[model samples]
Target: MSTERAREGLYSRVQQFHAEQMQALDSGRFEEYAETFTEDGEFRHSPGRPPARTRAGIAKELTAFHQERFAGEAVQRRHWFNMLNVQEQADGTVHATFYVLALLTRPGERVPEIAPSCLVRDVLVEEDGRLLTRSRRVEHDHVPEA
Candidate 1:
C-alpha cells in the first residue's frame, strides 16, 4: 500500500479500537474493556497510582476503581478522542497520540461534569490481521483536587 493509504488504514483501525473501548466502558463490560488489549498489555491511569500490567489486572482494578469512585451514582460517561497522530513502525506496529475528553453526567445534576482532558498514547500491533493494543498510557491534562 502507498504511504497515504497505509496511514488511512491505520487511522481507521485506531478509531475502531477507540470506539470499541468506549462501548465496553459505557456498557460496564469491564472484562471486555480489558480484552481490548493484548494479554500482556498495560493501562496506566494518571492519578490512580499503580498500573494494570495485564488484561486481567485491568479488569480487576478498573471494576473496583469505578465502583468505589462512582458507586450508586447514576451517571452517563462519554470518552472522546481528538487530534490523533498515528505512526507506522518499521515492524508494522502503529503508535498514536491523541487527546481525550471524558464527560460525566450525574443524577439531579443539571450539566455533565467534564473530567479534565487527558493525553492518550497507545502502541498497537497487528496480530493475525487484527489490531491489538500492547500499551496504553493516559496522562492527565489537568487533575482535579481531591
Candidate 2:
C-alpha cells in the first residue's frame, strides 16, 4: 500500500476507536471506557487540574464524576468529535487531535445542550495489536488555560 493509503487507514481506525470509547462513556460503562487506555495511561480533563493517572485511576475518577454529575438527575452526556487530525509519530505512536463537544440531554428534553466544546490531543500506541491511548489532554474552548 502507498504511504497515503496507509495513513488514511490509520486515521479511519483512530476515528472508529474514539467513537467506541466515547459511546462506552455515554452509556455509563466507565470500566469499558478506561479499558481503551493503556495500563499507565494519563488523562487530563483540564489544563489546570492534574491528570488522572493509570487505567484504574481513570476508571475510578470517571465513575465518581458521573455519579456526582448526574446525582438525582436523569441527564445523559454524549461526546462528539470532529475535524480529527491523525499523525504517525516517529516513535511508532499515533497522535490524534480533534474538537470535542459535550452534549447534555435531560429526561424530557428534546434537544441536547452543549456543555462545552474542547480541543483534545491524544497519544495512542499499539500493544499486542490493540490500540490504546497513552495520554490525553482536553482544553475547553471557553476557559482560558493558564
Candidate 3:
C-alpha cells in the first residue's frame, strides 16, 4: 500500500476504535471497553496516577469511575472522540491524537452539557487484523466541577 493509503487506513481504524470504546464505556459495558485495548495495554489517566496496565485493571477502573460519577439515575454521560492527527511511529505503532469530550445530561436537560474536554493520545497496534490501543495518555483542557 502507498504510505498515504496506509495512514488513511490506520486513521480510520483508530477512529473506529475510539468510537467503539466510547460507546461501550458510556453504556456500561466494561468488558467491551477493556477489550478495545491490547491484553496488557496501559491507560494513563494522569501523570501522577498509576496506569491501568491490564485488561482486568482497565475494567476495574472503568467500573469505579462510572459508578462514582455517572451511576445516579438522573445523570448520564456521553463520551466522544474526534481524530485530530495521525502519524506512523518508528516502533511500528500508529500514533493518534483525538479531541475528546465528556458531556453530562441530567434529569431536566434538553441536551448534554460538555464537562471534561481533553486531548487523548493513543498508541495503537494491529493485532489479528484488529486495531488495539497499546497505550493511551489523556490530558485535560477543562473539567467542570461536578
Candidate 4:
C-alpha cells in the first residue's frame, strides 16, 4: 500500500476507537470505556486530580464519575466530539485533539442540555495494529491551566 493509503487506514482506526469509546461511555458501560486505553494508559480528568493509570483505577474512576454525574436522575448522556484533528507526530504517536460536548437529556426534555464543553487532547499509540489512548488531557472552557 502507498504511504497515503496507510495513513488513511491509521486515521480510520483512530476514529473507530473514538467512536467506540463514546458509545461505551454514553451507554454506561464504564468498564468498556476504560478498556479503550492501553494497559498503562493514563487520564487526568482535571488538573488537581491525580492521574489514573491502572486498569482497575481507570474503571473505578469512570464508574464513580458516572454515578455521581447521574445521581438520582433519569437521563441519557452523550459525548460529542467536534472538529477532531488527528495527526501523526514525528515520534510515531498519534495526537488527537477535539472539542468535546457533554450532553444530558432529561425526562420530558426535548433537547439535550450541554453539561459542559471542553478541549480534549489524546496521545494515542498503535498497539498490535489497534489504536489505544496512551494519555488524555481535558481543559474546560475558560479554565486557565495552573
Candidate 5:
C-alpha cells in the first residue's frame, strides 16, 4: 500500500477503535472499556482532578462513579463521537481528537437529556498488534461551579 493509503487506513481503524471502546463503556462493560487502554494507561477528566492511572484504576473509578450516578434508576448513556481527527506520529503513536456528546435517557422518557459536550484527546499505541490508548484527556464545554 502507498504511504497515503496506509495513513487513511490507519485513520479508519482508529475511528473504529474509538467506536468500539465507547460502546463498551456505554454498555457498562467497565473491564472491557478499561481493556481498550494500555495496562498503565492514564485517563483524565476535566480539570483539577487527578488522572486515573492504570487499567485497574480506571475500571475501579468508572464502576463506582457509574453505579452511584444511576443508583436507583435504569438510565442509559449514549456517547456520540464526532469530527474525529487522527494523526500518526513519527514515533508510531496515533493522536486522536474528537468531540463527544453524551445523551442520557431514563425509563418512560420520550427525549434523552443531553449532558455537557466534551472534547476528548487520546494517544494510542500499538501493543502486540492491537491498538490501545496510552492516554486520554476529556474537557467538558460546561464550566463547573465551585
Candidate 6:
C-alpha cells in the first residue's frame, strides 16, 4: 500500500478503537472497555502520572475510580477527538496525537460541563494484523479544580 493509504488505514483503525472504547464506557461495560487494549497496554489519565501497566490493571483501576467518583451519580461522558496526526514506524508501529474534548452530562441537567479539551498521545502497534494501543498519554490544556 502507498504511504498515504497505509496512514489512512492506521488512522481509521485507531479511530475505531477509540469509538469502541467510548461506547463501552458510556454503556458501563467495563469488560468491553478493558478488552480494547492489548495485554500490556497502558492507560494514563495525565502526562506526569504513571500509566496503568497492563489491561487488567487499567480495568481494575478504572472500575474502582469510576465507581467511587461517580457513585450514585447519573452522568454521561463522551470523548470528542480531532486533529489526528500519525507517524508510521519501521517496526509497524504508529505514533499518534489527537485532541479530545470530554463532555459530561449529569442527571436532569440540561447543560453539560465542557472540559477544556486535552491531547491524546498514543503509541499503536499492529499485532497479528490488528491495531492495538501500546501506550496512551492524556494531557489536559488546563487542570480543572477538584
What TM-scores do the predictions have?
A: 0.87, 0.91, 0.83, 0.87, 0.89, 0.84
lDDT to native, each model: 0.84, 0.90, 0.81, 0.85, 0.89, 0.80
Tens digits of lDDT, candidate 4, 30-100: 78878888889899876577888866788899887767867888889888888889899999999999998
RMSD in Å for all candidates: 4.5, 3.7, 4.9, 3.5, 3.8, 4.6
Which is the better candidate, 1 or 6, if ranked by lDDT? 1
Clashing pairs in 5: none
The TM-score of candidate 4 is 0.87
Residue 146 local lDDT, model 5: 41
Q: Candidate 4: what lDDT? A: 0.85
Give the higher-TM-score candidate: 2 or 3.
2
TM-score of the candidate numbered 3? 0.83
RMSD of 1: 4.5
What is the Cα-based TM-score of model 6? 0.84
Candidate 6 lDDT score relative to the true structure: 0.80
Off by over 4 Å in 4: 1-8
Q: Name the runs in model 3 displaced over 4 angstroms.
A: 1-8, 46-48, 143-146
lDDT per residue for candidate 6 within 38-108, as digits (tens), equals: 88888987556567768788888778878987888888987788988989988877898999998889989
